[model samples]
Target: MTESGVAAGFLTLVVVMGIGRFLYTPLLPLMLTEYGLRTEQAGFLASLNYVGYLAGAFAAGPLCHRFREFRVLVAGLLISCLTTAATGLSTDFVWVTAARLLAGIASALAFVAVSGLVLLIVARDGRENLTGLYYGGVGGGIVLTGLAALPTARIWGAGGTWILFGAVGATLSGVVLLLLQRHDEPRHSAATPRATLPWHPRFARLVIAYGLEGFGYIITGTFMVAAANATVGPTGAHLAWVVAGCAALPSAFLWSTAARRWGRLKPLVVAFFLQGAGIILPAALNGAAALFAGALLFGATFMGIVTLALSEGASYAPTARARIVGLMTGIYGIGQIVGPALAGYFSARTGTYHIAIFIASATVAAAGGLLIPDAFAHEQARERR
Candidate 1:
């Protein structure tokens, strides 16, 4: 693959997966209105996507040992893209739920498999210099979803808008698929060994932190728009996501650039704390500006965690990296699976989303604390050989 080929393939893969993620909030209110859903009802359906994703996350590892990832990835993207488009065509909540569930599962398969592969591919050259180009998908999709939502907000309702975006994504996937040279992109590094099943103790701690982050980050991200709506009214919801998207555009660059200089663990710890503060701040202040800033912080660091985690796991015994990532991702998926449901439960009790956000902040703070001992001890343990 040419440099341009890598860029195109990586971005399309990320965007296809990211669409499953960013689609919800932009479409949530529309789903609620179109389906006449209760808050919990909507939430349950939304959480179902995570459930499917969790299942997919677990399967990616074993499959990695068996299949070529780019092939699997292309298949996953095609399925997800089709599902997203189909989800749009549905009129009822059940149909939408089914589509989202399938989309989530397919997207997860693509996400975990490609991510595991990308980590392997990038580590080969020692540069991974264009890493930001890969993550740019999140920011790009955020912008795409946000911008797409605006035009359809008045005309087509939620389902129609989802269909539109889904069509766009699916169509783009075909173009991207055609451009990719399947054999060229799959790089099994010479320095790397066959992926093993389990890892040392340090992997467990990192996995826990990732899970907590999944729980913590989504608690706020799930409800950030609602908070913005309550804070500055309707405009705030749009602005909040927009700010998150705008902030995200530069985040991969900023964090990845820093990781190059500062190394992964400490920079990641600081990033986690910053993210925690972001999740907590809007809850405390409960205003438009605060929510916007919080969204920005989240945008800046959210993907950074995954970047660090992927890179960190890659540095482990080469034979163990995929399984390590798979396990850690599964743990994180558990957190995502639980986070929104907990937030919904808390919101129902308190009649405000702030408490949930605060809880999320606490979770992130705790995750950060775990890294303190993890950072130093992990290195010392590695050196004991």
Candidate 2:
């Protein structure tokens, strides 16, 4: 049953995130050519999606407290599947944008609910190491969706591809629902006392660093395929996305292993630095090889950073885990909201994405520096105690 629960959660993430949330990245270039969307308009749509994500993240905590987590997950998956299909039904910009926004909201709800449920299931089974496997579902989705793009595009253009992805998401969601049907409804207990850790500078640094990550990583995630298409061609772009997905698949487990051996803070800091390099590589150098390398690096670390950062945040406020996660998610959502629009604006103004990518790299590198101080501070605090 625990294994089934984990499988259900994994499939839920694959549908909500891989198909509903991130399919946009691989489809953006096609949308530009087929639908005639400007770079800025694409950015606008991405930002709007993030806005919906922010709202959903904020709502998930309260909603889960009030209702069964499985119910919330089902509702989110349903919305995501429907909205994703809806994107294929129209060429109207307003309709497409609305679908993306709603899909984003659904993705967030599903993500939060599924993650919490999976963790609970893992804890119950005493298989904490499997946590990475649960989160790896997102990368699995990325790879599957990326691979689906080519054949889908060949058979049915951009709109057809959207419809196909929607159908796939819907099917997967149904499977997950079936797998989870045996689980009992979750019950809420009395709230625990909040941890009384000092409002240390390290905590603030973590928040800011995470927000910066949100800003830095998203630029490449959003536009890498588009940029690659322009520089190398369609094949190269597809390869880049696939490479990223492949690299991302095992990254969580690898990072988790490193964290256990070296400690979380050091591993996280190194991840930030490596991810910064990944974000800049394609922009700084020419050729398909460079782009692919960048994608690999980016994919390898981005999700790992997410896992590590959230764990760090939870450790800092163990008694208030949900609240802290929500707050950090909200901040991260804000960074996502700002990143694409900012990148699009600069791309439009300069006729290149290089400047925006450079900015993203620098911001990520600075975030790494922020973590260094936090690591040292944490060590000192521990020693003093």
lDDT of 1 by residue, 282-326 (tens): 778867778888888988888788777766766665655556666
Q: Write the per-residue lDDT of candidate 2 for residues 1-385, one digit (tens) a residue.
A: 8888878877887899878878888888888988889999998888888888888888886677667578789889999999988988888999999998998889888887777677667666786667677777878889997888877887788888988888999899889989888666456644733335436777778888999999999889889888899878887798789899888888987887876676678889999999999999987888877888899999999888987887677666554445566667778888899999999999999989999999999999999999896666666447423
Q: Quote the lDDT for 195 in model 1.
A: 54
lDDT of model 2, residue 206: 87
- Taking all chains together, each candidate's TM-score versus the true structure is 0.91, 0.93
Each model's backbone clash number = 0, 0
TM-score: which candidate is best? 2
Error at 200, model 2, angstroms: 4.7
